[model samples]
Every structure is written in structure tokens, then in C-alpha cells.
Target: MNKHFLWFFLLFCLGAAAKSLKCITCHLHTQPDRCRRGFGVCIAQKHESCMILQIFQDKALQLTYMVCQQFCRDLTFDFNNRTYVHKCCDYSYCNYDM
Candidate 1:
């Protein structure tokens, strides 16, 4: 009756509010800025976000990787004379511009 209808409405509203995020995928060679190996799109699920990982060597861009990563974190660090940057976003196709 009314209780069932109320539950249904609430579930519908929650589903509408929780939208999935889309991300770009790339695994390529050192061609500067392009997706040469695995170029596609992914949909982020629960506890997942669109992520981009850029690798720099001697202040020069070496690689760019993008995907939908679970438990993603944004940070920057250096190791082996290379700099790594991780950026996470919650919007659809947000990693495309990174």
C-alpha cells in the first residue's frame, strides 16, 4: 500500500542520485600525449573514481595513464629520478582533460 509505494519512491530517488562516472583508458608508448595501446572508456562503480597517472622524467612528460580506479588517491611523489602524479575525479569523463 502506501508504505510500499514510499519505499519504491525512495529507492528510485537514491538510484537517480548515485550516478556512475566514466573515465578514459590509455596504455601507450612514449609518443608525448596519446593513447596508443589500450584506448577505451570505463564506468566507475561503487567506491571508484576516475583517475589519471602521469609520469615525468627530468621535467619532461614521459607517459600518461588513465582509468577508473577503486580507492583512488591524489598525490605526487618522485622515485628513481622520475616524478609520478595521481589525480582522481568523481565526474563523468573527467580524466579526459588531464
Candidate 2:
């Protein structure tokens, strides 16, 4: 029983950690003073490092958001018609609309 509990705990932690992987390779090098929109489209910077890790579950539709930064956020989409808003802290916050 203890072993099973330990495994479940670790899995939970890993799942949460993977959801918020940072795009440091792309966003960290950007100018700190510029107002970069989602995917940095407004700054003329080409960054493709943004990603949404492990979001799909079943065939159902959903909306999700990710935190971008202290002053920005990101949006996600699915088969639904609602706009999911994310704060700057969530991992999917920097993902661009598709």
C-alpha cells in the first residue's frame, strides 16, 4: 500500500510540473521592455518554442488558459465556442491561437 501511494504521489507531481514548462529558449532572450502579445507576434520576434504539454484527455471539447507573465496571459481553444483565458503563471499562457 505504501509503495502504491508513493507512486501515485510522484505521478501527480510530474503531471502538474509538465503542464507549466517554460519557453525560456524563446521568451527569455526577448527584450524585457517590449509589450509582446501572444506568441510574441507584436514584437517582430519569431519564436516557436511555445508549447502546450499534455492537455488532451478524451473526445470531449474544452477551453483552457495559461498564465503568460506578470502582466499578460494566454488563451486556448477546443470544439467549444468559449474563450479560455489563462494567467501568466500557467504553462499554456504563452501558447498562440490556432
Number of the top candidate by lDDT? 1
- Model 2, stretches more than 4 Å misplaced? 25-68, 73-98
Model 1: per-residue Cα lDDT over 1-98, one tens digit each: 69999999999987875665778888663545457888898978889999988899999989888899999999999999999999999898899887
C-alpha lDDT (0 to 100) for residue 73 of candidate 1:
95
lDDT score at residue 22, model 1, on the 0-100 scale: 77
Question: lDDT tens string, model 2, 1-98?
Answer: 69999999999999976654454222322222332333332211223234422133253223222222343434455434344333233234344432
* Whole-model lDDT, model 1: 0.86
Runs with alpha carbons beyond 4 Å of true place in candidate 1 = 1-18, 29-33
Worst 10 residues of 2 by lDDT: 39-48
Clashing pairs in 1: none
